[model samples]
Target: MTIDLINDMIPPLKITDDATKALIWMEELRLHALPVIKDKKFLGFLTEEMIMDHNTVDAKAGDFLLKGENCFVFEYQHTYEAVKKATDFDFECVVILNDDNEYLGVVVLSDALSIFSQSASIQSEGGVIVLSLNQSDYSLSEISRLIESNEAQVMGSSLNIDKNEPTKFRLTLKINKIDLTHVIATLERFGYKVVAKYQEVKSISNEKERLDMLMRYLDA
Candidate 1:
């Protein structure tokens, strides 16, 4: 899925402008990191840990913040890349900038995770469809065709070879907006053996009784 870049945006400013105020600003924003820019050019991020590492309030603003040209990404770049890029520099957030190095925004790791959580997950909506078939029977192109036939796009998928036997494999697909009955039919018609389904089975419990039980359970 393509990530929306507009969700990631943070202001840029120099650390030396007011270092103490920056710390308070970060705390107020609930951020552990922030972007540092000079003359509209991207600089490295200033992190809470880095500030604490100095262990000296006597140090000037420049001394406490990250320096040099190592951190920062081209502003229009993909938002999915924040995790990898952040890991490379041990940065809590990566500063994003334009072609001319003008301030664009900053992508906090937490912000990206928030976006991830809010997005639809297949497990929460559609049930998983697993098929036991010969390894040779599987083809990405054909599978894509079958999935589209039911007007559903594959959201996530995984495959595993039978450990006890060779040439037999299991393919698991997560489809979008499909009823379990239809999903089983499409796979079964294609000569795939439906192995297991993990849908939320309807409970026979009454709604009021279920709630009372759950509340008692939580209380216990």
Candidate 2:
């Protein structure tokens, strides 16, 4: 599902606002930094540590040097883009703007993470399998076909470059079935190396135990 960027908007601060007020707002909102705007234009971000380091509590936000002025995303951008921007800039939040270049608000890293965790792919009920493969040998269509041959479908998948080997990649797949024995066999038969696997059997067992306890309590 598409994310509504505007709904994640965190209120911004005016450039003329005092650093002390900014600090108070940060404390109240549990934010490390906040965006500074002027005439609906985003100037930059002001951090509590920056103010404390400069001893500029009484100074206006505009009077101090702000950071991450260019660290922003358009309102139409995806939520992942905001997360990426925040991670790339090492910023506490990501600024948002409209098509007209007007300041909208900021998306806090914490909120972005929450949205990401609740995303469909993440919340889907499935078993996860991680595979290590050479870049040249990687073909998504081939992998899907192998999975389908085992009567299992890939629910979702992600890839990351192997840190130790630039020519290799780590592929993570979410499979619809909790039992992945057949899927793993099929992939390995096709020369795919299975690195790790996670199943829902433990969770299912726990749930069954809880249901049994509930039934016993009802009978008592």
Best TM-score among the predictions, by candidate number: 2
Report the Cα RMSD per candidate: 10.3, 9.4
Predicted candidate 2 versus true structure: per-residue lDDT over 76-173, tens digit per residue: 87665676677667887788888898987777766655654544444556677888899999899999999988888887676767656778988878
Count of backbone collisions within predicted model 1: 0
Against the correct fold, how does model 1 do in TM-score? 0.51
Local distance difference test, each candidate: 0.59, 0.74
Runs in model 2 lying further than 4 Å from the true structure: 1-9, 123-146, 157-172, 177-220
Candidate 2 worst ten-residue window by lDDT: 211-220
Alpha carbon lDDT of residue 26, candidate 1?
A: 78
User: Residue 152's C-alpha lDDT in candidate 2?
Assistant: 83
